[model samples]
Target: MSTYGSRGDVEPMAALAVTLQELGVEAVVCAPPEDEFRALLERAGVEMVAAGMAVKELIAEAKANPHITLPERARKVTSRQYEAVLEVAQKADVIIGSGLMPAAAGARTVADQLGLPFHLVAFQPVTMPSPYQPPVAYPGRPLPPDVTDNRELWKHDAESMNVIFGAAVNDHRVSVGLPPVPSIRAYVLNKRPWLAVDPVLSPWRPSDLLDVLQTGAWILPDTRPLPAELEAFLEADQEPVYVGFGSMAMGNAPAEVARAAVEAARKQGRRLVMAKGWAGLEAIDEADDCFVVGDVNQQKLFPRVAAVVHHGGAGTTTAAARAGTPQVIVPQVVDQPHFARRVAELGIGVAHEGSVPTSESLAEALNRALGMTRRAQEMAGQIKTDGTLVAARELGVA
Candidate 1:
């Protein structure tokens, strides 16, 4: 398995690797070489072959140089994958690609070179093209305002993909002695792509464009106990509202976002547990009513919380849902909006109107979320925890 992106993208692959190993298959992951990623795979007893640049460095560079085109960045990442994935592909019976588009493209070409079957998996349904939904617009390339038809928007989407990744992919293919692909979009996604999302949270509607295999969300079973401080806080009073933006650098003002979350939870007469994630959020002030933590296990903590206010990444959203915790989804970008909408549609949470949340907006959303606790609890029973086992069986590992 090979992937590159945030924790949301890499952690699922680690979960799948662990499942495959339990089924007597030797699983190795080629992913970004960040310490957190290495620790995650290490805990699963899986081998990690570093691929691509460090994700934090990539994000920082992108922010530093706003003028760098998407195509240029894609080319650099694709080149790195070609160099790193060759050794792993040589030993694997099959290749699986996920996360960023450029990384997947390079892995597919490596599979082509070695005559290995390549499968592309999406953690969310939004990335997969369909007539039921339009494609995610590329940065700096918005869809035409006049184009209302989904099909038309998808056509435009295809063109934009080719414009961004076609050359980078085709150039690598030709260098590897493989024929150049005509359409980068079709080349990567036309095969029966697998969608690794919970059917209840993000359902897939069939389309003519691609054959999709909808599997439940791949989850890493975390057994780590919460810290003593957090445990004491939970026992002291009413359940606190939990707020964290896992892996997201919460825009330019993370401190502002943290303050708003703290204020909102206070208005509802609830204590607050804030996670200082990649955004490095801190408690606005030192008080017994609020506790700040880092990289704790949500699986153990979410059930104790009154509500979850978060940037709606796939894994976090699914974790909170499985714990039967109501949510307030403040979506930032990419597939986050899709998850936000689904949470609202299920009546388990409120999708904040926009990304930047003030105290008033968060309090309002939290009020709505707290009222739907019963629905959330009922829905939790319907969430499947066997998604990793299912994926392993599908891969013929079990």
Candidate 2:
């Protein structure tokens, strides 16, 4: 299988690949050549195919212009990824995409050519193409027709959808002699579709979707040790608000954002644990209430926090949800806004309005998240109960 995105995008697929293997299926993940990610998957004994471009470069380009990044770099890299995975999937009975991957798309193309069955896996509600009506955030923009409640966003029609596929991706596939497939109605997992993901699932709405099959986030068994700084922070405070912006902080003025986040932490009287990867916190003086750490087990850390504040990456969003902790989504770009809207619409948290945010906005959103009502907690719990075991059954592995 292939996953095409930044670290947030690749890690979930790695975890899912592990899960799939646990069910006695051998799997491999197509990832960028990042040593950190590459090493982890290597340690897991999963085959890793290195894509041509670095994820860092792709992220930089995307941050510069999110409007076309998905179609350009994401789609192009993914198309080339297929050549690497074909050696394995051709001999296998089934193929799956962690989300959208060039390999997955390529694999899908090969599947149609060879008449094989392929499944597309989603980690976010917006990606699932489910049938549940998403709450209206922007009035008159009342959600697209492609989103639904379904857990799996399988491609029903490959023809028309293929045309809407990015030109870069299309050219790559055609160069490889792959026939164009028509676009199928993609199930929108979350109603918001503006985020960074496959665009073939556009023009969708709640009515145009199906009910969610899998309801909860996939839970991975944690066994890694925490870095000393992270451990120290955990020991210093029983629970703190987790804060970090994944790859989103690379190009932005991270220090300013970090300072604002730190200030907000102080006002709320909550301990702060920023992901060590947080870009701009080096200039800030560390207080007893603040700590910076590397390699947090998000599944483990998020639940223990009083709240979470971060760029609204899909994986982080789900991690916060799984922890049953309210979140303050300070989206930087792309799908961040889309996910932030979902966080607010679900009443799971508040969104910091506008592309740029201030400490006050961050604090307010944090306050609202920490003040989640019983209804919001219950809804979060419902999603927590999602069973991928049933998904295993559907794959005929359970």
Candidate 3:
């Protein structure tokens, strides 16, 4: 198994590895060395072969060079990352991967070489060829509804991805002695596709390929006890509002988000637990009602929070929902806005316009979430936390 990206991506891959291991399937997770959950995977008894690239550094590069096109981004992934995946693939029976660029592309080549089946798991719904949803694009916005089977749009989307990453993928193929591919559509075709989400939060897209499977939400198995100070703070009064933008670089968004978080807490009369994620929130420093922290298990903290304010990554969204907390998502990219919409549609939360939001807007969102606490709790109760096991069973690994 291999994947790339932030905690949101790695954690689910690790969870799946754990499930596979429990089912007697030996699994090793491969990804760029900087994954936050490398330790989590190792601690959970899943072996990790570090892909040499630093995922955070790669993301920083991508963010810094916004002019970089998708194909360039795809081709730009360090050869070391692909090498690590190839090395690990040599010993595997089935190649399972997550993420679009390196993982799926690399796994496709490896699987073809070894005559092994390649399976994909992802938080993004459009990763598969979907007949129900419009092709995915950057930033959050509505798209024209699918009037019929979305295969053509899906093909267009796949070709666009090929344009972005195909050059680099072909280069790797050359190094691995595999023939270059003309299109990337093969990566999504006739493959085992798993959408790692909870249906209650993200309903199945009707346009998804008939073969696509739902793996449910994959959260870290460990929920470490909160620090004593955090424990005491939670007991202090009404639950605090949680403000975090997981894996998104701050790049000047921190101060704005911090002010909004503080102001929202003040307006709503709640304490704040602000996670200083990739976005290092500066205004969080001087706020008396706010407690700033680095990454901690949201699975443990969410149950105590009054509401969740986030960038709407899949892992965080599921964790918040299962904790029975209402979420206020200010989405920034693919699949995030989709999750935000589902939160609102389910009557459990609200979604902001985009990533940039003001204190007034945040306060309103928090207030809206606060009003639906009971509904959020009900949604939480209905979520199947055992999705990982279900996925393993479906794979027939056990």
Best candidate according to lDDT = 1
- Deviation from native of the Cα of residue 7 in model 1, angstroms: 0.5
Q: 195-308, model 1: which lDDT tens digit per residue? A: 999999988888787789988999988998999988999999989999999898988989899999999999999999999989999999877788999989999999999999
Give the poorly placed runs of model 3, Cα more than 4 Å off.
63-69, 138-152, 206-210, 283-287
Rank order (by TM-score, best first): 1, 3, 2
Model 2 stretches with alpha carbons more than 4 Å out: 42-45, 61-75, 98-103, 127-170, 184-215, 278-283, 373-381, 385-387
Q: What is the TM-score of each candidate against the true structure?
A: 0.98, 0.75, 0.91
Clash list (residue pairs), candidate 3? 70-164, 71-164, 131-150, 131-207, 132-207
Q: Please say which candidate is ahead in lDDT: 2 or 3.
A: 3
Tens-digit lDDT string for candidate 3 (337-394)? 8888889999988999768888898888888889999999888888878878877877
Local accuracy of candidate 2 as per-residue lDDT tens digits, 202-243: 223444545434423444455666776677777775678878
lDDT, candidate 1, residue 2?
86
Top model number, TM-score: 1
What order do you get sorting by lDDT, best first?
A: 1, 3, 2
TM-score, candidate number 1: 0.98
Error of 1 at 182 (Å): 0.9
Error of 1 at 55 (Å): 0.7
Clashing pairs in 1: none
